[model samples]
Target: MKTTKRVIVLAVLLAAVVSGCGEVTVESETTSTGSASEEKSAVAEKSEEASKASDSEVKAEEPTAEESAAEQPAAEEPADTATLGEKNALASAQNYLRFAPFSAQGLREQLEFEGYSSEEVQYAVEHIDADWNEQALKSAQNYLRFAPFSAQGLREQLEFEGYTSEEAQYAIDHCDADWNEQAAKSAQNYLSLMPFSKQELIDQLIFEGYTREQAEYGVSAAGY
Candidate 1:
């Protein structure tokens, strides 16, 4: 009977040990599964946070509409209010220059005659492109075509036409005219208009700005 009892106790202990081992194994497996699920959750959360951070950085890198507009170039400014007047004056000056050569003073006078203000006339004259010496030369040529002129007479006439003394002298120096011939022509023109004594012709030529030697040459050449 004791042997039978011992065997029954030992069998019960063995079954208990097996059941405890089974419980321990099931608990360990459940713990490992829960840990793996937690790990996966943590990794997914980290990936989502990184994605969100990347999106935020991209948004920060891009400029807004207002900032983009500010970065563009500004528009050009308008022209000055007096620009039209200046242009008109410049055009008028150019047109005047195209028609005839003029001294600076003469051009200013012409502009003034056209009813422009003194300031505007001065501006036009200052801005016009012309060589005063060349203008003087042209004036001299024009005068010689219509009438004879002594060197001094021509220079005076040029000065009267608004050329500076220096400019008038330049024209006279470059005219390539023969003063004796000019004096002779003047004498002839005077004789054609009315008869005159030799002394009277000579005196008249002198009064007309001829030198003494030129006057004598003119009277002698005219058979006086």
Candidate 2:
């Protein structure tokens, strides 16, 4: 764009210089000799030809897409037609996402709880950029960081947090946990709170969504 502008400015100056020479030749034509007058006329003609050639050169040098866009007039700003309530809802949604992950349904419900109308909540959820699968994955990782859960247990927790069934399953599939290890961790957590016989502890692990093999492995690994 800058290069295009410089070329245009140089072309204009060249035209101006040629116009000045023509003006000088006009005065010389009145007082100069025939040969001298003819000489000046020839110089003026050459100058006019050079100016035309310069213009053609300038026209042949096509502007790039960016340069052509620069030549266009500034566009007007798009109107902000959203209501104040809707704007607030959008702002609130953004703030929530910055601090924590939220599914579309979860965010909509949160906005509604904050007193935003259905229209505002709808606008917020539509406009806010959230990948619900990512949100579910984050929730699963967060839960596992502080507590242990079997795969099914974690999926249930994500669903309770308003993720869809598909999103919950997606999180479970991608969470990358060994069910037996999670069951073992859960067993350890349970034992930290109180004592349990080996069979009783296995039953407890199963109740918390671990498979039978996973539950038995957990209880045996607990040194029972």
Among these predicted structures, which one has the highest TM-score?
2
Taking the tens digit of each residue's C-alpha lDDT, what string does model 1 give over 1-224? 99999999999999999999999999999999999999999999999999999999999999999999999999989865544555566578789778776778888787777777777776666666678999899889889888999999999999998999999999999989999999999999999999999999999999999999999999998887
After superposing candidate 2 on the true structure, give the runs of residues whose Cα lies further than 4 Å from its correct spot: 1-78
RMSD of 1: 12.4
Q: Candidate 2 — what's its lDDT?
A: 0.91
Model-by-model lDDT, in order? 0.89, 0.91
Off by over 4 Å in 1: 1-82
Count of clashing residue pairs in every prediction? 0, 0
Best by lDDT: 2
Question: For model 2, how does the per-residue alpha-carbon lDDT over 107-185 read when each residue is reduced to its tens digit?
Answer: 9899999999999999999888788999999989889889889988898889989999999999999988888888888
- In angstroms, how far off is 25's CA in candidate 2? 59
Residue 218 in candidate 2 has what lDDT? 89
Model 1, CA-based lDDT: 0.89
Residue pairs with clashing backbones, model 2: none
